[model samples]
Target: MKLLIEGGRRLQGRVRISGAKNSALVLIAASAISGGEVILDNVPKISDVLTQLEIVRAIGGRASWTGENTLCLDWSGPLEGELPYVHAKKLRASNLFLGALAARQKRVKIPLPGGCNIGSRPMDLHLKGFHLLGYQVSMKHGFIEARAGKIEGNRIYLDFPSVGATENIMMAAAGTPGITVIENAAREPEIVDLAGFLNAMGGRVRGAGTDVIKIEGVSEFRGARFSVIPDRIEAGTYLIAAGISGGEVTVENVITRHLQPVIAKLQDVGLDVAAGEDRITVRRRGDLLPTDVKTLPYPGFPTDLQSPMMALLSLARGTSIIVENVFENRFQVADELKRMGAKIRVKGQTAVIEGVERLYGTQVRATDLRAGAALLLAGLAAGGVTEILQAELIARGYEKVVEKLGALGAAVRVAGDESGEPGAKSV
Candidate 1:
């Protein structure tokens, strides 16, 4: 489907955010290792999370919805075989099950994972962590097959605190025979949520929100019900949308502290930002001021918001410099923004954006999830209609994006000339 974002009006409304993508992804991995029924609440219905549920079912597991945002996963059935290649290549999160599968069956075969073309997100860290835990891994043809003599817990230090690798190793070490200590771990709040869910399932995990983590091995664990936290990234996106469109928007069902960096940045750009309990309100009255931003890990400006922030800074009064320290190829959206009459130049990891009075609408393709969001936001600020192709990328992350934008008074719609079912143009 294609999305057309009509620009030049202030967005005005309240938006409710769904469960976090980062937390839900790791929770899927946690559920794969549970012994009984695993109940997960407040989970978003985004394509990536659905892909994870499909992956679980493909592995001979059963998943049923108790509510719109609640799912129960029962893995009592035998895992017929490894994850199918067709499903495995759908998203990068598919690779996370390797550690869980290896812990469960002692052997697993999975195809190379695929996802957005944001950058070269290699799995070396995950593979290395698995190796440290007594798993003998090999790649043959296009599948990765791993066999563990027995999962032996040991000290695993990640060279970088990669979130994916951290969750993979934690799930694998949960059922192992000894203590597993992971240093230099990711301190994201999602990591804490995963640890909480695992602990509720009778697994011993501690220090999740710290740089160091300790996991004591247990023979097995039973499933329990858990509620996921709100998506802070989505909250930040709408907050920026409210700022750029000169609108007053209230974002509800969010953890206000998690958005400190983004909120601070918006306030720095002269937008009125206020937080109340679980909601945040952003308002814009005048031209956005120029600000410099650098992306970092948790507690820092998130790398996920860098691209959209670039779009927001495009309307600043002066040149804005954005340095991406997390992902190398995240600047793919720069070209797409430039297509819409935006002035942006990239040199290595830093992008220099020159503010412009106005941006004209144009056709652009969403290269990745966040890039798709950035393009859509840019379209909302442009003068005329903007056609965005590859909207499936946006669906991977944002749930009901067009609906959310429309609720905020943006003239957004899904339209394409391709032949399909009727009303397929406005989904």
Candidate 2:
């Protein structure tokens, strides 16, 4: 599918942020460790979530949505340890099941997971953690097979603080026989949410939001209810959209603390930002100031919001520089932005963007999830009409994106089909 956007519309309204996709995926995978009804609230109905739910069902677990944004997963039945290639090859979160399955059934066979072609997201850390837990890991015919007679808890240190690796190890260790200490663990809020879910499932976990996390093994799990955190990246994207369109927008249902770095950068770029208890109001007063940004882990500028910030910086009054430290191919959106008459030069992980007076809309392609969102923001800020191809990539992350933008009064709509023609309703 494609998105047809008539540019130069000022977006003005309140937008409620959806639940964090990152948090929800890990929670869904963690549900496999328990054999009861687990209720997840504030879950976004996105493609990625649906894909994860499908995987849950394929593994003999029952998952259904009881409300518009709530999911109920029942893992009371016997689950199949093997994950088919067709199911695992669609999303990166499939790798999360490795830990949960090994903990539950002592074996798992899953293919190498796939997602956006951003960079090399190797599963070595996940596999290494499994091996440390006494699992025999092997690869044959593009599938990973792991078997363990007993899961033993041990102290494992990750070379890098990888979020996926941290969540996998934490979940796998929740059912071991002893205590597991993970040093250099990821400190993202999503990891904290995973720890919270595990704890609610009768698992003992401590120091979740810190670099060192300790988990004591448990013999069984009980179903629990939990609510996912709001998506900070989505809130940041909307805030940047307001800046790019020179409009006023209020993003609601967000934890402002999770967006400190983004808020700081937006203010540095001369945007008027005010944070309330659960909402953030953003307004653009005059010309925007150019700024430099470097993506980092939690408590720093997030890599997920880097592309959207680049879109806003493309229209700044001066030059701006962005260094992507997380993903090597994250700057793929630079070429798409250049297609819209923006001056951007990318060399390796660094991008030099010279602010243009105005951007003219043109046909562009969505390279990845966040990159697709950046293109949409660029389209809204451009002078003429913009057609974005492969908008499905955007839907994988953003929930009802066209509808959300339309609610905020942006002149954007999904194409009727792949022909790039606008319709009365969005996809």
Candidate 3:
């Protein structure tokens, strides 16, 4: 599918934030180890979430949506030990089942995961953690096989604070027989949400939002109910959308504390940013100020929002520098932005962008999930019409982007069916 956007439209209104996609995936994977029904509220109906649920169903589990934003998963049946390649090949989060399945069935055979071609996202840390838990891990014929008579808890330290490794280790260790202490664990808000879900199911976990997380193994997990946190990346993207379009937009249902770094960066760029208890309002004050950004872990500038911020910085009055520290190929959007007449130079992990007076619209392709969002924001701020190809990448993360942009008064719509020519149109 493609997105057709008419540029130069001021987006002004209030839009409610959806649940975090990162949190929803981990929560759904954690449901596989539950003993009863797991009910999750405020879940985003994105393609990634649906794909993860399909993997669960393929393993003899049942998942269904009871409401628009609510999901009920029943995994009490006898689940299969091997994860099918057909379902596991669609998403990166499919690797999360390694730990859940190992904990439940004590044996797992899953294909090497696939997602956006962003960079070398290795699964070494995850495999190492599994080995430490007494699982015999092997890889051959493009599949990972792990088997163990029993999962034993032990102290494991990650060389880097990887979010997937932390979540997988925590889930696998939840059903073991001893204490598992994870050093240098990821401190993202999604990690905290997963810990909360496990705890609600009678799992003992401590220090989730900190670097060191300790989990005591339990014999079983009961069904539990939990709500996901608001998506900070989506909130940051919409806030930058308001800045790029020179409009005022209020985003509600967000946790203010989770966006301090993003709010600080927007303030540094001379945007009018205000935060209340659970909402934030952003408006373009005047000419934007050029700023430098470096992507880091949580409590710092997020790597997920770096691309969208680059789109807004393209229209600033001075030169801006961006250093992407997370993913090596994250700057793939720079070439797409250059297609729209923006001055951007990328060398290795750094990008030098010289602000231009205005950007002319052109056809661009989305390289990844966040890159898709960056292209959309640039299209909204460009001078003419812009058509975005491979917009399915955006739907994997963002929920109802066309409908949300419309509610905020932007002229954007999805064009072309699976058998039609790609095109754009104004709504």
TM-score of each prediction: 0.96, 0.97, 0.96
Better of 2 and 3 by lDDT: 2
**Could you say which candidate leads in lDDT?**
2
Q: Sorted on TM-score, highest at the top, how do the candidates line up?
A: 2, 3, 1
Error of 2 at 216 (Å): 0.3
User: How many residue pairs clash (N, CA or C atoms closer than 3 angstroms) in each of the candidate models, in the order given?
Assistant: 0, 0, 0
Please list all clashing residue pairs in model 2, or write none if there are none: none
Q: List pairs with backbone clashes in candidate 3.
A: none
Candidate 1 stretches with Cα past 4 Å from truth are: 416-427
lDDT by residue (1-427, candidate 2, tens digit) is 8788988988899999999999999899998998889999999999999999889999999999999999999999999988877878889999899888877788888889999999999989988888898888998788888988567999999998999999989988998889899999999999999999999999999999999999999998999999999998889999999999999999999999999899999999999999998999999989989999999989779999999989999999999999999999999999999999999999888999999999988999999999999999999999989999998899888887777888888888776644433334544
Per-residue error (Å), model 3, residue 372: 0.5
Per-residue accuracy of model 3 over 18-62 as CA lDDT, tens digit each: 999999998998888886799999999999999998998898899
Worst 10 residues of 1 by lDDT: 418-427
Score each candidate by Cα lDDT: 0.87, 0.91, 0.90
Ranking by lDDT: 2, 3, 1
lDDT of 1 by residue, 1-427 (tens): 7887778978998999989998898788678777578999999889999998889988888998989999889977778448888888889988878877766767888888888877777778888888888888888788888788666889999998898889888888887789999999998889899889889888899899898899998887787999999999999999999987889999999999889999999999999988998999999989999899998889889999998999999999998999998899999999999998889999999999999988889999999999999998898899998999998888888888877887788877778534332222333
**TM-score winner:** 2
